[model samples]
Target: MGVVPTDNELTGTVRSLRTSNSGLGIPKLLATLLSSQPEWSVSEKRLRKVIQRLKSEEETNFHPTSSLNSALDVSKYSNKLKPILFGPEKGKGLVATQDIDAGEVLWREDPFVYAPPWEIYEAQMAGTASWQDETRSNLTKGKGTSNKLGDESPLSKDAIWDTYRSFATLRNDQRWSHTSENDLARSQLENTFRRLHTVLINALYLQHSESQEDVTFDSTNTGSIPAPSRSAAHTKQLKRLLRVPIPEATLNSLFSWDGLMEGLGKMSLNLEAHGGLFPLHSHLNHACRPNVSIRHISPDGSTNSILHSPNPSRITVIAASLIPAGVELVVSYVDPSLDLRSRRRELRAWDFGICQCGRCLEEENSNSNTEHPEISGNRTKIEGGDERDVGQLEDELRGFLSV
Candidate 1:
């Protein structure tokens, strides 16, 4: 007779049954077991059906398509590339579905949100309640914020307290809420009133926009998110659009003393300060040898302008080399022209990962071989015995520092 099952073995079998059945109602479980496990012979199709049923339930109740996933939906972007869970270790990367030629425009993206230096400066100026012309006019009186508050830059704690006081004062004024001028001033002057502070506000606002259906912030009154304006009139209107309300919880989580420090960390890791936050662009992993090069293309038809502008500009990723279908696309995050040591160090420090690309690996091996010539010679000989092999080794040795 087959070994008699112990109580523990029976318990384990029942547990597996319960799991596979997904805690179905007693009546359903009895019927399913009777039909699927007749004579204890469950088929693969029945087990698969159980898994599909469980997954369908999970999808219906527990998991909704997330904002990031929604943003990355391939149909919304190009047909040339697709994002996927690249490999076991690398989380996400873009792969080519079709063979791409050199210099082809693989993708173009506009920043979801960005903060240029000017907006931050304007916010700082308004938060201080010091119109430069007014302050300059009062300079002769020696009683203006330019003199008494000259030491208080927006980054200082004193300036932050001043901003809070100023906001409170403005709120009390009858014109502050409805009057466009006062609304504009208060809009720019709220929060920490620093450039970085304003940028974080924008970043949070975009996140809020993305996840609004799933979660609600305390206040949705954060006025119209700031955008680049070309005229004084446009700037005035942009500043007065609307005020987004900051929930006390959100303030604590993102802008309190510790939260302020954390915002900087987010900026470093998640933001492209000069470039703006391009969710799709940030997904591309780094490599020592890159297949693509990014260029800031003109918002117009031509691709000339490469400098940061007041507004978000279109950025294009061009193929630098012919890439085959299904190949993982990579671009260098750090300057590839730097010496191997410097490039590796920069990648490790800023990117937080050592590149394992072919060039980086070769550099590492060459460095090791140089420190031990005998080992290098033995390996070179082991690789081949003919003159062609010797010539190849010499060429590799000569080109060791080329990258």
Candidate 2:
């Protein structure tokens, strides 16, 4: 051994190596460091100790708990409804604490995490400046484009991690239980991250290319436009960004993939549009003829204004009809106008299985009775036919009911 390297020197070397090559393994890092600094005589065991210490320091510095805790507050809405376990199959649901009148607001909540749909992500990757403006205009006119929930921007790694943390705290889903199944899930998550990473990199490259064109060309020039391509400078900038290390804990936990899936599962069950994961709103179970309706609202309580506003929207739960005390609050997961068979089919696709709501049960009983030929005939037509045929059958059924 020559001379032992100082702790500060060893720490700096390790940090530099990690910054240059984030995926470098410990053995390789040690060998590379020793080779570069032949004057230093550091043992492999000593270098390992320094590496662990640096990781611990980084983890401690990266706490987002304060912001997360502030955003998750539901104290204002706690008195209106309470979570109650119905059974293993239904899991936890919300019940009214007091009688709620029709049109009365029950609760308003912000999303724990928000991600735009694939279309929006593609637009961002393509560097389309007009996509957001068009989407906002459509939403204002009540001609909303997509049913999927999401915010204005493309999904970020930070948002993904936040979603994971929210799900980990909830611990309501059975999928959270760790087993051998996680290996497959982890692989899927890695693929998702890789795709997202590529999208972000490509978007950055395109943005830079556009800026370069603006600088190099004048408006008076009527020359043919050149195709976009990534420059060496853009690649260097992206490489620097990609080298930033992700927290070790986040990589190992559900946030990597399962947490994202859980968030999506909850979104499907709860939200209509304006993608977000509202914790309090999620407890309300599904019913065909539900007593409540959910909608997105701006901070000032304007329903339509949320579409174009830069501020995040909140989900407002309103009583559609009179809900008595001690009753469970529910909302329609799909269009309530759909016939029994159609409704059941939609719910089944959502993994809700057969709906056992009171209206559904009553309809099922009515269908079982041979006395209702019109109702049975309409159901058969809807099951076998397209939307136009179903609409025609519905009109015929309405005529019979009127008589």
Candidate 3:
């Protein structure tokens, strides 16, 4: 023998042999594709097929196994606020298991589940026929997606869409891309991260829509999702319309709870805001003279989470306002001093039937009759001649409050 091989050496030889030779013959460039990954070293089984192909000499019934089982994740920290609902249960509603106090920070949560923008586009293209038709009819066609962020010459659309976010793909997608020049091992090993602040911000906005009209795009115009226009400029404009923001601002301007007002009328749940959101706070029933109020803390310059931990990735919920025994713990979602009618309207939009709480009933009884001066219309008389214009009054109220 050239050299007497030990058991370990013999095993190693057999492995190399198994990798390089298949039943018919050895493999070709497969070895180069897998073994020379610039990122990290390949495992035995990982290189087997490539080696076999390079050798062009196959073995009988060869199978190479590797230690590439998927990693297991068993963390129990899920967003516990599963069923955020608005309802009028003759039942006690979402009552506080413990007492809450004023200036207390309630819990917060990542409200909206975010998906990659590319994935969003893909899903929309697949189901929404309007978007697909519009895209295909364009001179650019599929090129609408992968353009660079800025194309100075474009009359139509700019190119940012086609740019693949490698980090997002790695974290969520495992369909291993064959197009990239980077080695598979290197790509897999990369720990790059990109912040998705926009999704969080949109979630905040969705929680409270300051511009009521933004709630729904009055789809009276059936020509939704834009018709294909010949001009690249118009196509670009349509593209812009289709895009949602990618990053959300750290500071989100607060909205007085128009929705909360309606909830008060329905006596559904009382919710108070101490700044951050909470697990079950939204589910609290409403009482006119609620026990809780939302008090916003000052915003910091950089992005911040409501949670007070050293690493504020997760949000925390604490009591902002106090709750009382047998008080049905209500908190104001919007400004507290709203008159009964406006309050009822707001609650109605929030899906509450009516405000039957003590305060609301009192106001309604008073507005209906002049005899009870005690409840005399709670609304101040408009001293000017514009008293009859309830519509104007509504507009003024909405404008002043920024709801």
Candidate 4:
């Protein structure tokens, strides 16, 4: 038998219905609400929590995200690189699952995903399914408190824990904001995010002090710039950073953190930090002894988002020097702008172990006074440098040295 609706349920359902009218929310459009399917089989507990959210939302009279809603068409998205080997740690490293040859486009993806309307995330915050119960339970018991639930505690002294939504502050995967789905009768995100947390979230969440809502950026692909969104209290700080990277500037405001040491212990989520065309030059992973290398080729007139290749149409990975198959593949993470030490530091920060690829080892063994004739004046760094220049020069040799 169907369960009878409580007063809260009846009132909440009607209120929820009204907030979603075509004029307010996209989902409320007549064609959508009347013909939608039931939500997927989330647990009953999570479902009731959603009901509670409806009641809360109904009471708050929260306005829809009209600004974000009307901008991009909710449907259209590009499938550039459908990401393969995701990072084993906190959204950092990804590897090729299959053997990829030189010059092949290894992987490409839009990398940006649309997030659920702020309403859904807020509901999850208030103890709805996906995140609410999980966050409260985890926080009260203090297990995953690394996500940092300082003032926001559990709904009651006794509550069941759920992990789904708790990860918003815990993980750093850019993909969490993915807006892949165009239409759905039921919520399209719960399952996708659960899977995403697997690929990205870390257990040791580090805390920062930024307001998540105030951060915004322009789409490099679409060229759409947005003014930063911030609470009233942050107006001064935002003004100070008007021209600085809007994203990095807000990192300090992040109120949570990830604790797991990425790439050191367990595998974490690997993600694309920036989206652009990475020529074959971006593919190499160098070892102390290097085998492969990368070089950014800027054709006559290409924008920062696009690059031109020397060989007209196609780009390929090559043995900058003779590379044996058994050696690890390596690339210089920096563009041509980086010096040796700079290159090394960048790789170390990203958690790659010291490169000991074949080429790096060979240079050390040879110990030549001068570089190999083939390498002199070569724009690309075929192999990591040898130890010959390390201790003696120390600080002077910053880029690829001792990193």
Candidate 5:
């Protein structure tokens, strides 16, 4: 019987609370949200649930390892790897709980979702146009088209395609504002955004299959559109971002683009370029000389005898070296054989930071020094020799260094 907060209002309230310097508790956060929307008859209990959900969502993005580890535990499959908080600067990372020898399996997980290349989506779009034209013609002629595959399920192809249309229509709100200098950049981003949108839609549909709750919508809550699941929150956020109306439930639910962008960014930085979204494997940080190596084995269970069982396809993380108990587990983000400059440049450009591993430190120092330990003995011998020998040695040193 009262006005409920709009999706925009709810999103704004959560953002405000998160950005505030003061650590406001549940009581204060609820009070702040209520105060911001006094016209709404939001009960304390209902508001608390909303606040908690948003906070938890924020925490999952900021500290990804917690959620990843929790998923691992819930699976009930014995995993040797554990997630560890490496402080605010480093974020969350993985560590070994026991000593692991080379070639021993540490952890194996199926990707939460995998996104195919953009070309597939482009082809699908071209195909859909012809179908739409036929549908329009049938409607104009007062004819109803029959759905021969009449399953009418929530995850039906028709429902998924409808959701995909809504998702794809939304613009890339993250793109730069219109300007002369940004014209070309914006043009390029259109294709990039479309590619991302396609992948996000597919991933969201896959994630929805894992949701346990039923979808419920409020009919008379004035100005309010509720999105029940975290997955729904994701789609609702994207709808809000593009100033689109809140999505209505189709086949009992709607897909979200909310965490898709953030998840993609994390995947880019943490996962191997060859890999897609392996949630558990992505948590392991980078090291110049990593103790772990990932092996991509076929689902048919070929090559490795350990993977002879009928498990789903997975990228197995095996110990590359003997890792001691409580040691941090890491893998190289880039080829370690590259020079110090190349390694750091690759990390800075793509991975967002340079490696602080021991191998990196040793290489950096050795590369910076003018004299090498191998050539130090040569210098000492020349100093003790006659002037003629010393001159010849100096010339020879210059030639050797140049080569």
Candidate 6:
């Protein structure tokens, strides 16, 4: 008589089989188990019971509605700063809840989704000989590569689900919406998605390649390895896993060409230098003279001390100057030292139009006065006239201008 399999052993086998073939029915699953483990005696009725219990447990644990609630929650950071609508034109902005002293920390937040540099992503997609050589050289030197999280890492189903959820949340969030219908905005949206698509394609390729390599390595080391070549069927399974099943409507809304472009535009506006999008930090509007300073710091607040410390994922918002309660917190999106015209030009290119900040207004007014026709005419007369006349005219103009 063959040895009868215990309930625990049957449950474990069923789980492994289901993980590999999610669509396998109870009858087929039992047949596969029996064929593989011919020495073990198991009844089809007992196997069916185990599968049903597992399905019930999965249904109870996984709630689709709450999958993203934790990722989108900003309650922890709400005590110091809050989002307030600044009218239709300006939309929403962050405001200080109470008087904040200079150098005080307002909040620290992690990026919703962080990506590697555009150049790196492009290189990976192209798979150029130079890039391959560089990667090999770095490996030889014991140097770390650009995509530490992605390179040679086993793809986790949970990580893929989390990434998809975060992206979906970003796409649906109305706070990041831009109501502009200008050609410049449209151009920017297209460009943003062009780059995003490249990155996504390259990421998928990398994961698939890494998974294949893992399979190859395991087969070489162990005599008993399943799916030696990681066949097309297995590849299909991996692609399905990476895709993360979502409703047709939700998928269309998140990934349709127009939807993708719009989503990328929102990300482009708020993405940090290293391609990170912070939730609360995105609410701070631009200012010529910003009251808040943004800093990337390690958990202990010292980045330089740790060699190759992972990209300082957490950003600290410090009060650059004393900020009064209920005041809108702002940060400089461009260099503050830039002159008025140069600053305005840069801002315009970014679709921000002219800045109306106090410093910019004062500078613009001063420039306007200096260029006034009367002032120019008086200056010209003074330059061409005799020294005595020039002095008299200067005195007259100064008095007229109340200088």
Q: Which stretches of candidate 5 lie over 4 Å from their true place?
A: 1-79, 117-265, 268-272, 299-313, 369-403
Q: How accurate locally is residue 22 in candidate 2, as Cα lDDT from 0 to 100?
A: 84
Candidate achieving the largest lDDT: 2
Off by over 4 Å in 2: 1-73, 116-264, 269-271, 298-305, 310-312, 369-403
lDDT (0 to 1) per candidate: 0.54, 0.61, 0.40, 0.36, 0.56, 0.60
What would the per-residue lDDT of candidate 1 be over residues 33-127, giving only the tens digit for each residue?
54644545443455455545655755554211221345466656678888777443455678899999999987777766654423444444444
Q: In model 6, what are the clashing residue pairs, if there are any?
A: none
Highest TM-score, which number? 2
Q: What is the TM-score of each candidate against the true structure?
A: 0.41, 0.44, 0.30, 0.24, 0.41, 0.42
**TM-score: model 2 vs. ground truth:** 0.44
Clashes of each: 10, 2, 55, 59, 2, 0
lDDT per residue for candidate 3 within 136-237, as digits (tens), equals 325443545544435322222222122113334444445556666645554544422212222222222331213322222222432323332234665688
lDDT of 4 by residue, 39-136 (tens): 32233444446556765865664221111123333123211211222233223222333344555433222212222223444544443424223344
Q: Supply the TM-score for candidate 5.
A: 0.41
In candidate 1, clashing pairs total: 10
* lDDT (tens digit, per residue) of candidate 6 on 270-357: 2235566677776777888999887767657774422123544567788899999989898887788877655665566554656778
Q: What is the lDDT of residue 313 in candidate 4?
A: 21
Question: In model 6, what is the error at residue 85, expressed in angstroms?
Answer: 1.7
lDDT of 3: 0.40
Per residue, candidate 2 scores C-alpha lDDT tens digits across 76-178 of: 6757776777754465677888888899988766666664433444433333311233354244323454434364223332333334334333332344446
